[model samples]
Target: MTARRRWSTEEILDAAAELLRTSDAESFSVRKLAAALGTDSSSLYRHFRSKTELLRAVADRILLAAMDSYRPEGDWKQRIMSLAQRVREAFGQQPQLAAVWGRHASSGTGSRLVMEEILQALRASGLPDEEIPTRYHRIAVLLAALIAAEAGVSAITPEEYEQGMELFRVAVLGADPGRFPALSHFARDVRPLGADRHAAFEEILATQLAHIETAMRSR
Candidate 1:
């Protein structure tokens, strides 16, 4: 008889991530994962202590994938943009994974390495040592909020998005000009910079980088 192949940690995480992409967070569970793996719950327990632990690993795995191909080769601003782009691409591919960003504190090697690159970029920007932490926090908050927005948009179907946009158009375009002059005028004719989400991400990132550049100039 042939011996059975034990599942590796990477294999387990890959399976878990795929499962998560198809299901909402509330619906994901250890039993379900074990079933998906064609193994007993006890077998999964040997690798992950609990469902929560498994999820954190899966989230970190996404981060690892985001940074796996990063090659640092540019000025501080360019480097920052490259790193941010990689992260955006990764989250865009698996926005479901972004749902766990704030909920889990990723202490994995991947998270640490990413942070290191970010910090290096900040340091290279010539910000004072005293200002680095706050600046870093701001970047973190900005990226988290943007990625969460992308994930929220991804979670909805195209029909739902179109329906919501139709409602928004009705509300904005139909507003009384006398009562809401600016909104009525602006909302009526404005075009998006690009595909709405992608454009917004690029605009916001550029604005943030511009702010950093201004700070560097001031000092």
Candidate 2:
């Protein structure tokens, strides 16, 4: 008879990550995971002390994926844009993982490495050392906003979401014609080509980071 091979921690974590990518994190239970793996729930506890540990492992794996793909060598604006785009892509690929990401403390090794790289790159760009903390905070806010926007948009069909966004554009832009000329122009542009949201996000992030860098240098 052939001997049975035991599952490795990586294998278990990969399975859990697959479940997270395909379904919501809340739906992933040890029992369900074990059943999917052709084992009992007790088997998982040997690898992951508890479900919380399992979730953390899943988060770590996802963060590693994001960090691995990040390339920080370039102009500060380009580097920041690349980092943000990679993050957005990573989350977009696993929307179910967003909830876990949002709730967890940003103290994991993978998370820290990514932040360190970003901070180092920003510092090399002539940004003041004193402003590093503020820059980090702003980057966090920008990432959270991007993740929230992408997750919300993914919840609906693309066509329906586009239509809804168009309607919102009109309402917000048309509310006060003279006071919001740029917004009115924005609505017209969006209504015509339907904004490429990812590209728009990249542009906005680059713009914001540039301003922050400028401000930091002046201080």
Count clashes in each candidate, considering only residues at least 3 apart in sequence or on different chains: 0, 0
Error of 1 at 54 (Å): 1.8
Alpha-carbon shift of residue 161 in model 1 (angstroms): 2.0
Cα-based lDDT for every prediction:
0.81, 0.73
Candidate 2 local lDDT, 1-219, one digit each (tens): 854457899899888888766666577789988987888888789898888778866776666788885666678767777777777777777777766676653456767776887888778778778877788788877777667566656755678977887787668667575887777666555442234777778777877887886776677
- Candidate 2: residue pairs that collide: none
RMSD of each: 2.8, 4.7
- lDDT of prediction 1: 0.81
Ten contiguous residues minimizing lDDT sum, candidate 2: 186-195
Write down the TM-score of every candidate.
0.86, 0.72
